[model samples]
Target: MSPRIGYFLSCEEYSPSQLIEQAKLAERAGFEALWISDHFHPWNDAQGNSAYVWGMIGAISQACSLPITTAVTCPILRQHPAIVAQAAATAKVLTNGRFTLGIGTGEALNEHVLGQRWPNTDVRLSMLGEAVDVMRQLWTGESVTHHGDHYTVEDARIYTLPDEPVKVYVSAFGPKALEVAARIGDGLCSTMPEADVVSSFKEKAGPGKPAQVGYKVSYSTDPERALDYAHELWFNEGIPGEAAQVLSSPKHFEQLAPLVTRDAVAGSTVHEADVDKHVAEFAKYADAGYDEVFIADMGPEYEGFFRFYEKDVLPRIRG
Candidate 1:
């Protein structure tokens, strides 16, 4: 099948209503699907909003017919796997079996908000494995009592399940997490356009499993202004290594944001006026073997970005 192109809704920057509206706009624009960030908190002070994702999914289900996927949610700490299973099941039914549960080991920003200590990557992966097991077992619609190393589910059953099982996509940026995703995930979700990651996933998960990727673009007629917005709102993205995953809160990110140069953010995100440049950036991900490429607008405004992509970008990429 040809790769699908979708919109990446940044919940941290848009209200739930706005996100649903954007989903409708995306569908009207002929986009194939929607990917929403599942964050409890905004990355920094400038990008100011983080709506409850599950609630937004319910709204999006009513607003549009596009399939939905969480860019990545942590189902281990902030929520248990059993609860996630129920939520996914409900989401699937609401969207008419068009929902995909994209999950990850999680970041400190979202998972640590409940005052829980953030474990290292290795430990989190272990926890994620157990959590996936719990969620999958519960999805069987049987009374599942799972007492695993990281989670315990007592006589749990999800009654409101869809006809087909909700697809579970696991997010990964590193080696260990990649292995876990390949072994247990229904598909793969990632933010970077790394072909090696795809190679690794397909190598282990077999060649036919889906790999979905997300990329950020600060699309504006004015490239310089777009670059400035990207720097302000997503400079935290340029934080190298596991810092983006390990930082406990937005303040911690803010403390390091100044050190991130505008060029760094510009380099990380596609801050461009040229529609061709945006199309090429997306092509890289699709060419890298991603089954789906979800592009997020990093600029403050969405109308221009949406319009430009709808008119100029999507068609070229879809072709």
Candidate 2:
């Protein structure tokens, strides 16, 4: 089957109104879905924007018909699972069943804001597992009381659930968490174009489940400006392993970013002026078995990127 093309709404860099405008543009440009980042803080101070994701999502529901998914939210930290379940249920009702709750173990950058000690990855994964279970129970439209190792819910129910079950997609970057996603999640959310992860998820989740991947690239008429913009905004993207997960703030991330080599950050993304090159980069993920591929243009201008994509990139890949 041909893969679905989607636009990623970068909430860290755009205001709520801009996000809604981009959502409308993306739908008009023939993208099939929308992925919005749910974050309490921007990765770097230079990015300069962090709108509340839930409020922005409500605006998106009214502005566009495209299906929406949080690129990944952490219900395990900063918010209780019961609250996450309630908010997700309302989103599903508002979007008329077009919402998917994409969740993850979370990063210290966002989760540490509440002044809680950041737990290690293993504990976070355990919390995420229990959280997903709690959410699923509440989505059944029955009052639920859950007391797990990480969280507790007493007499909580989601009255606003849609007729269809709200799909839950789990994001993972490693084997252990991938296993958790397979065991509990309805779909998989990831960033890498690694086929092995997709293969493993499909094998473990059995058949007929979907996996989605989001990738970043910079598109501009000026190749040099594109590369510079990508480096300035996402140099920290090259931070290896779970380092990005543990860093507590954008200042910490900024300090570590300069150590990342240009090639390293450029390797993490496609920073080319050519539309065909951008299209090819996306095809790599689709060929890797991602059911949906969401692309974020790291260039400062969204409208130009959207126009270039609608005129060139979408047709080649969506075909």
Candidates in order, TM-scores: namely 0.97, 0.97
For model 2, how does the per-residue alpha-carbon lDDT over 1-319 read when each residue is reduced to its tens digit?
8888899999997778888889999999888999999999999998888998888889899999999999999998898888898899999999999999999999999999888899998999999999988988999999898877888788887878789888999998888999999999899999989999999999999997899999888877887788888888877777787778999989998998878877777666777768778878987898899999999878577788889888988887766
Clashing pairs in 2: none
Alpha-carbon lDDT of model 1: 0.88
The reply for model 1, stretches above 4 Å from the true place, is none
lDDT of 2 at 249: 87
lDDT of each: 0.88, 0.88
Query: What's the distance in Å from true for residue 32, model 1?
Result: 0.4
**Alpha-carbon runs more than 4 Å astray in model 2:** none
* Weakest lDDT window of 10 consecutive positions for candidate 1: 264-273
Candidate 2 C-alpha error for residue 129, in Å: 0.9
